[model samples]
Target: MTPNALLLAHDKPAALRPDQLRQFQELGYLVLPGFLDRDLVARMRHEVDRWVDDGLRARSIDSVKDPEKFGVPPVMELELPAHGELITWSPLLEILDQLVGAPYAFHHLHSDRQAPDIPGKPWHHDYEHSTQTDRSATMIHALHYLDGLSTDTSSLVVLPGSHRERVDKTARAHLGTEPLPGEVVLEELPPGSTVVLHSALFHARRPRPGVLGKPRYFVDASYCEVGPLWPPVKPYWRYMLRRARELNLAPDRSELFTELTFAEYSRPA
Candidate 1:
C-alpha cells in the first residue's frame, strides 16, 4: 500500500472524530502524522542524545535490571523539559482521552536514540496486566518518532487487530520482525509523528539492511485507563509518579500521576 494510504489509519481531524475512534477501537492502533511540534521534536532529540551519551540511559536500565541495587536513576525521561512537555502535550492527551473513554494514568516513559546498527527486535506486545486476561481496559503507548522515519531508519511493523487476541506478550517472539500477513510497515512518517498503539498490539522494530541507518530518535510513553489496577514495570514507579507530580507535568490530569492506578509492584519470577 502507498504511504498515504497506510497513514489513513487515523483521520486527520483537529479533534478525534467518531470514525477515527471507531478505527482505533477495531484496529488497536492509530497513526497521527506530524502529531508533535517540530521545535519540541528538536529538543527531544537533544535530550535523547544526552540520555544516551551521559550514561543516564545505562543507569536507568540498571535500575530496572537490579532495582535493589540501583533504586532509581538520578533522572527519569519525563524530568527533561521537552520530554515532560511531550508527555502532557495537549493534542496527544486529547486523542488518548477519546480512545480510553475514561481517566487514564501515566504508565511509563522511555527515550532512546537507537544506534544505526540496531538489530530487529522480536515481535512482542507490551501490555502489563498481572494475569494477562481480558483486553477490556485500554493501555496505549504513544510512540514518538522525533526525527521521523525513512528508508534509512528502522521501521515499525505491527500486526493489525492482534490486540483483540488474548495471548502472552511474547507469543509471536519466534516469528521475529519479518513481514507477516496483514502486517503494516510504517516507514514513511514525517518528523514529529506519533503512532499510538494499544499496548497489547503485537509489533516489532525491523532495522534496514545494507543501507547505513541513521540514529533514530524515538520515545514512547504509555497510559492505562482507570479501571483495574495495572502492573508497574518499574520498581521505582512510585518515585517516578511523585517526580512527575512535583514537576507538575499534568496539573489537570489528576489521574495521571496518582498511585491508585497501579497495584503493588511484584518482582518478576
Candidate 2:
C-alpha cells in the first residue's frame, strides 16, 4: 500500500511490523531501498573484491565473468574468519526470527554475478534445496548490492508470494524462463539495502550488465530453527556449553533443550 506501511515489515512483535510479509505471500516480492549505512556497503564491496581476487590467484583463472550461472561458483563465504569482522554480528537474523515466528538456520551465499546486458534468470523459489513443508518453512534473504544497482543497471523481478504454487517445469527451463501467472514487481534498491523474502516466493533476476566484464554482486543467507536443525528430525542436542555457537541454540534460547540435548534429545536419530 504505502512505503510507510512497508517499512513496518522489520519492526514486528511490537514497535514495527511487516505488512508485506503477508503481502509477499500474495504478491511474491518486496523492496526497501536506501536502508543501510554507506560504510557497511563499502566494507562489503571491498571484502567481495578481495575474495574474488584471492580465488582468481588461487585458481589461476584468466577471467570469472559468469559466476551466477551455477555451482560453487566462487562465492565468498562471509562467515570465514577473514571476512567475519566485515559485518557478521548483525541482530537482523534474530529480528528475522520474530518476523517469521519460526526457527531457521543460515543457508549458503550465492556469490552471484551476471554479464553485460543479460536477460533475467529463471523464475524459482530460493529454497531450491530444502524439501520440507513446515509452515515455519521460510527463507530470509538479506541482499546487499554493490556498484550502483538500479532498475536500468539491474533489478529483481518477483511474482509476489508465488511460493504457495507448485513448481512449473516450463519455468524451470534454462532459457531464462518466464514468471508464472502474476504481476512482475521490480526491486530497485540502493547499494546497501537488504531484500528479505520467504523460501517459497518466486523471484527472478534481470541483469543490465553495464560493462563487458563487470557484473552485479549480491549476498544471501537463510535461517532455520534449532529443533528441526538436524535431520531425521532427531532431538536437537548439545553439551554443557553455556553459549550457542551458531551450530546450536544459545543457552538463553534453549536451556532445557541444551541440557537435554545429549541426555534426552539425542535418541536414535
Candidate 3:
C-alpha cells in the first residue's frame, strides 16, 4: 500500500478514552477485540506464511545469535510489504501514542505460525532491561492474533496488574503455563483482535490438549517510549530501523526510526 493509504488507516481508529487509559495504567493491559483491519490482517498472514516457509525467519534468528558471522539479515520482517504496513498502521500507532504519552521508537517485530500441537510457552514478560530496574518508562508489545482465539486454539493467559510488581521477567517462570488465581484467560476474539500489553506485564500461551486446532498466525511488534536509551534486542537493530526509514513506514514520525532513541546493542543475560 502507498504511504498515503497507510495514513488513512489511522483516520478512523476507535478513540482512546480517559477511562481506558486509566485501566491500562492500573491493569497493565488492554484487549482491543478485532482492532486490526481485516484487509491488513489478511495480507499479514500471507507475509507470515512466506516468512516462515521461505526461511527468512530462520535466517533472521541466526543473525541475532551470531551477528559477527551472519551480520545483518538478507531480509528483515519489516522488509516484507505487509509487515511493513502493519508496523505503521495508523490506528495502532495512535493507540500507542496515547498509551506512551510521548514519542516512541520501534523496538522489534516477530512473526510466526504455531502448529496445533505447539507446546505452551511458560509464563514470562518481554520487558527488556539488563538491570531489571524500575519501570521508569513504557514499552509495549502489540500481540496480534490474525486468526483470533477459540476453544480449539491456544489461549493467552495474563495476570492482571502484574506490571506493577517490579520483578524480573522470569519471576514467574517457575509457575510454568499453569493457571493462576486472578488470571484472565483470553480464549475468544474476532479475526483481527489485538492485545496491547505493557511489556512488563506477565503473560503466557496455553495450548489446548487433545485438540489439534488450526494453525495460529501470530505477529507481535513492539515500541518503547522515548526517554532513557532503550536497549535493542536484535544485534542488527540499526539495519532494521534503516530499512524502515528506507521504506518510509512512518513518514511523519522521524523518532520511529531514529538511532538516538536506542542504547548500544547488548547481549541480554
Candidate 4:
C-alpha cells in the first residue's frame, strides 16, 4: 500500500508535542504509525535487493571501510539512490528538536539487516558505543522497511524505557548472548516509518522468518549537538545536518554518510 506524500502528518513527524514528548521521556519510545510515505519505502526496498545481490550502491560501502566492521557485507539501504530526498527531513527534524531541545549534529548514516535465523545486532546503545559525549537530546533513527516488517521476522527490538538506565561502561560479547531476563518488544512497523530515540537507549535489530530468502532493510541514523565536527568528519556532513534542510537519501548528496573508521562510525559497526 503506497502512502501519499501529502498524507505525512505532524503527529508522526519528529516534531513532538507536550504529550508526545512526555510519552518518549517516560516510555523511551513511541510509535508514530502511517507517518512515512509508502512509495518511497518501496523504492528503498528495491534498492536493498539490488545491493544485497551485488555489493555496491551509489552511497553505501561494499568493502570493509573499518576493520572493526569487517566480515560484514554492507550492500543495503539503496533508498539513497532511489528516493531523492525529504524521506527523513520532515518528521525527523521536528521530533529531534523536541527531544534534543537544541540543534543536533549528524553522527553518520549506516544500514543493518538480519536474515531469518541469523543472529541480530549486538544489544547496545549507539552513543555509548560511539564513545562520544553527545549533547543532542535526541538521536534520529529513521528506518525504511524496504520490505514490510512483521512480528515473527524478529524485526527491530527495543527496550522502551531502557534509555533511562545508566551504563557508562558496557561489555562486548564475542558471540550473541540471550537478551537479559525480561520482556522484549520489537518496534514492528510498515515501510517508510521512522523511529527517533535518545542515544542513551538500548536498541537492537533481529531476524525474522521471511518468505524464505527475503531479509529486512533499515537505516541507522544518529544525531547530536552541532559543534566541532567529530574526527574524520566530512565537509558536506556539516551543511546537510541542519534542522531546516530536508533529510533525503539522495545518492547525489555526499555525507548521506561518509566512510569512517570504527572511531569514525559508531562503535560495534
Candidate 5:
C-alpha cells in the first residue's frame, strides 16, 4: 500500500474497513488523523496538564520503579474522568475489536506532556511476550497525539512490517534515531491524531534540533488478544486492573479488565 493509504481521515466511518484491516495486518500500523473529537481533546489536555503539574505522573513512575518503597500510586491515569473515557471510548474499542478479531484485555496506559527539547528515543518496540517465542497473538499500542504532530515537535518514525521479525524490542537500538531505508516519518498530523501500532513494530522518536517547539501531549494505551497469559509491566498492575474494573471503564467489554488475562508481574532484567 502507498504511504497515504496508511492514514485514515477523521471524517471517515468509525468502523474499520476491510482494506484498512488488511493494511494493519500487513504493515503493522495505521495512522488515524484527527481520530478524536476536539471537545475530548480539550478535556484530555486539561487532565494531562494536571497529571504532570500535580506530580501524579512522577509518583506513578516511582511506584513502577520502586514499588516496595512507593507502593500503589495515589492516582492512575485512568482514574481521570477524561482518560477513562478515552480508554474505553466505544468507537475506538469497536475498531480494536475488528483489528484484534477476538477478545482482548487492557494492557497498560501512559500519559505524558513532553518538553519541546526532549531528546530523541532510539528505535525500539514494546511487544511483551514472557518467553519472547512467537507473534502468534496480537498486541497493539494506540498512540494518541493529543496536540498532534508538527514541525516543532518530534516526528514518529516507524519501520513498516518490522513486527514480523521475532527479535528483542531493542534489536535496532544501535541504530539510534537515524533514518532507515523503509522508515516512515510522521510529523504533520492534526490535533487529536492517533496511530495504532502492532506492539512489535520497531519505531523511534526523531526530534528536530535547534527549533523551539511546544509541549507534545501524548497518551498511549495498549491491549492484547486474550488467548495467552500476557506479562504485566507494572508491579501494582493488579491494583490498576482492579481499579479499572471498579470504574467500569468499559461496561460492555467484559474481558477488558479481567485479571485472568495476565501472568504475575515481573520486572525486566
Candidate 6:
C-alpha cells in the first residue's frame, strides 16, 4: 500500500471497507487518524496526567517487576473511567471484530505520558505466543496517540509486512532505530489518532534527539484472537482481567475478560 493509503480518516463507519481490511491483512497495520473523539481524548489526557503525577504508573511498574512484594496494582489503567470506556469503545471493537475476524480477549492496556527527551526504542514486536510458535491466530495492539504525532514528538517507524515472518520479537534489535528499506515513518497526525498493528509487526519509536518538545500522551491496548491459550505478560494479569469484568468494561462482549483465554503467567527469562 502507498504511504498515504496507509492512513484512514476516523469516520467511525459501520464497517471497515474491504480494502481497509485488506490493507491491514497485507501490510500488518492500519492508521486511523483522529480515530477517537476529541472530548474522550481530552478526558483520557487528564487521566493520563493523574496516572503519572499520582505515582500510579510507577506503582504499576513496580507491581510487574516485583509482584511478590507489590502484588496487584492499587489501580490499573482500565480502572480509570475514561480508559475503561476506551477499552470497550464500541466503534473500536467493531473494527477489531472485522480485523480479528473472530471472538477475541482483552490482553492488556497501558497508559503513559512520554517525556520529550524519552530515548528511542529499538525495533521490536509485542506478539505473545507462549512458545514462539506459529502465527496462525491473530493478535493486535491498538496504539492510541492521544496528543498525536508531530516533528517535536517521537515518530513511530514500522516495517511493513514484517508480521508474516515467524521471528523473535526483537529479531531486528541489532539495527537500532536506524532507517531501513520499506519502513514507514509516521510523524504527523492530528490529536486522538490511533494505529492498529498486527502484534507481530516490527515497529520502533524514533525520538528526535536534543529537541525538548511537549510530552506525548500514549495509551495502548492489545487483544488476542481466542483459540490458543496465550501467555499473559503481567504476573497479576488475572487480577487485571477480574477488575475489567467487575467494572463491566465489556458488558456486551462476554469473551473479552474470560480467564479461559490465557494459559498461565510466566516471567520472561
Model 3 over residues 1-269: C-alpha lDDT tens digits?
11111112224655677877888898888887777888899999999999989999999999999888988888899999999998998888888988999999999999998888999998999888766677889999999999988877899998878988888888999988999998888888778888899999999999899996889999999999887888899998888898899999899999998899889998854
TM-score of each: 0.95, 0.63, 0.94, 0.65, 0.96, 0.96
Q: CA lDDT of 3 in candidate 6?
A: 65
In order, the Cα lDDT scores of the candidates are: 0.86, 0.47, 0.86, 0.50, 0.90, 0.91
lDDT of 2 by residue, 1-269 (tens): 22421442323332224564566555544455544546666766666666655663232122122223322223234434323432233445444655566544443344444444766667666543334355444555655565546555556666654667655423444646454575464545555556666656666676654444346666555444444443211111121122224433332444222332222332221
What CA root-mean-square deviation does each model show from the true structure? 2.3, 8.2, 5.1, 7.1, 1.6, 1.5
| Candidate 2: residue 191 Cα off by (Å) | 1.5
How well is each residue in 51-76 modelled by candidate 4, as lDDT tens digits? 55565543344223443444333322
Question: Which residue runs of candidate 3 sit more than 4 Å off their true CA positions?
Answer: 1-12
TM-score of 1: 0.95
Which parts of model 6 are misplaced by more than 4 Å? 1-14
Candidates 2 and 4 compared: the better one by lDDT is 4
Clashes of each: 0, 21, 0, 14, 0, 0
Error of 1 at 138 (Å): 0.6
lDDT per residue, candidate 1, 129-178, as tens digits?
Answer: 85678888889998999988899899998887999988999899998887
Candidate 3, pairs of clashing residues: none
Q: What tens-digit string does per-residue lDDT give for candidate 5 at 102-180?
A: 9999999999999999999999999999556689899999999999899989999999999899898888999999999
